[model samples]
Target: MKAVGVVVEYNPFHNGHLYHLRESVKKSNADIVIAVMSGYFLQRGEPALVSKWERTKMALQGGVDLVVELPYAFATQKAETFANGAVSILDALHCSYLCFGSETGDIAPFLHTNEFLQKESEQYEEYIKHFMQTGVNYPTALSLAYQKISNRKDTLDLSQPNNILGFHYVKAISKLNSNMIPLTIKRYKAGYHDKDFASTSIASATSIRNSLFDQNADISSYVPNDTYTILEKYKEQYGVFHQWENYFSFLKYSLLTMKEEELKSIYEVEEGLENRVLKLIIDSHCFQDFMEQLKTKRYTWTRLQRLCMHILTRTSKQEMNLINQHETSPYIRLLGMSERGQEYLRSIKKNLKLPIISKVSGFHHPLFEIDLRAAATYFMIFPEPLRSRLLKTEYTTPPIRMSY
Candidate 1:
């Protein structure tokens, strides 16, 4: 049986995501679809709008066969590392194809570009160093390198978020030498960063989230009925959505109390950034203000946010680097699954390479500890019932299994 894999951060699953899931199944002609998704924290180094449980339920409700947690170490990382973790999990699960939504809606150029980048590694490196010395950021430097080395500017348009991620996904597949074929579906309606809701069935997750944050606004037009219902239910009971500003005080407290040596040890803290962060934390008011104060040519907003997250969670660079060298993902933790997904898992149970974790006690790893700490930090912003309920150890939380 053929299976298609998708890497996602549902944030809150909406109509556009539903469209991608359905279209991916048709495009891959797969018997099952597996989604590797982020947990509470996201790639941009911010808390998710809702809990992972709610997001996983949204995925299963939207027709995903299986949903697995992308570990904290990799989920909240740069594009390449994020792709590597997701691709490694899917490849180990024996997925036949990797399906993703891209603004360009074509996979051929990404493939060709990946090959070119690999073939011109030395030249790319030289160009990257040269651009870095000129004070350009890492991503921009890499893009400049690609243009100089490949002379195929059209193949590497880093301005488009989906295109940038697609390139990294293909690169990760090649690095693993995995047999997964890459496929892309044209993104519909809104762009990744589009904040305004479009008058269409498919709206960007960003728009849907922004609407949800406003108490009086309606978002039914942007999301599936089940997703809307889930948000409504949570909004009534435990307060559903959150932005980084909600947790800024705790992060500020963390920074103020953190030692200079400890701050320096956190992942992504470089070039005496610990000292800069210490000085800036005193003057910054909100999360946005803090990010603005820290942003420079060397560090993008996203990179700075990631650094903030590391400080908040107290994740040391030593621990993260050591974990990455030792394991791609030590175990696959099931988050949610439909009946069909469970059936697929049953069929592959004996032949699987990585351990399928439905319970927390199934595996013990240092990375999992980091995930727990991250979850604790995320849940601190939530209300009492939810905060207490979700703060349980990984072993205690059962995977959400549903017939839908």
Candidate 2:
């Protein structure tokens, strides 16, 4: 009953994801696969194409034995924090291995990179600080710093998105001293940010999402049958797929009503960003326009979007600070599980490091409360009857049980 864990968002489980899942199972040689998935929102600071529940069904149908929700505090943060939370949960679950999709595809490079960085941590920090002070974004600063110290061809290229995340996954495992062995699978044809369909069958999630929104394009060929079915079902029931533009009006309202001091209290709102948002919010007509005006060399679009998402959900800096005071995730929240997954959990339940949450009624952690607020805010984009119904599901919907 060995288990392999993967940190995923499954924005809408597609062919590339299916390939990764299958490949992970083969590579890890484990009996079951467990996924730590994002809820409501994604790491890029965008709302998920569908809710977590629907995505859970997709995961189960696509072959994941278990699915756990990545708390909002970690899911929407940068790569380092996101990996720390996700990897810790897998370790808590007592997974034997962690499998991730990366550009490098070789586990050796990630190990080498982590070890090199650890030995050169002081010099790396100095280089990062020097780069950041020159007006480059954080990701850019990291890439520059890595290049400055490590010229070895065997190390991962930090500039690639999946490679960056995979490196952090390795770093987190070492930091926690977890027993899980790390594995990697090369990503399929399409790139992470690919906007158009690059392959006939192996399209990126970004391309699939863009097609879905741009023309209501049929994505059946790009995803598994169950994933396609779930996508259609979600859109049919919710009337529209979730996206940032859908919540633009509400975001505008939030910015309009909140005072400068209040906006400044939100997480990631720093360095006079509150004032800049206050001044620009009124003149902007849409989310894209507002972002364009607010975008600066120092702030990446992803970072800015995350800031806006925090403002929209009223996620205060104090709340995040309180949650961060703890070393790892406060709890492991189950979203779905198969028969094998249930059996595995039962075996490990006694030895589990974190409490496993099947229902939210008795839970009272600050991180859990942020997840609740995020759920509430996410459903606000819907019309009245639908909004109330969807919001109620946040508490009422139990972890999905599946047989296969």
Q: Give TM-scores for every candidate, taking all chains together and pairing residue i with residue i.
A: 0.96, 0.99
Q: Over the stretch 254-284, how does candidate 2's per-residue lDDT look in tens digits?
A: 9999988899899999999999999999999
Model 2 TM-score is: 0.99
Q: At residue 125, what lDDT does model 1 achieve?
A: 94
Show where candidate 1 strays beyond 4 Å. 383-386
Best by lDDT: 2
C-alpha lDDT of candidate 1 relative to the true structure: 0.87
**Would you list the clashing residue pairs of candidate 2?**
none
> Which 10 successive residues of model 1 have the least lDDT summed?
150-159
Off by over 4 Å in 2: none
User: For all candidates, what are the clash counts?
Assistant: 1, 0
Error of 1 at 166 (Å): 0.8
lDDT of 1 at 13: 92
All-Cα superposition RMSD per candidate: 1.6, 0.9
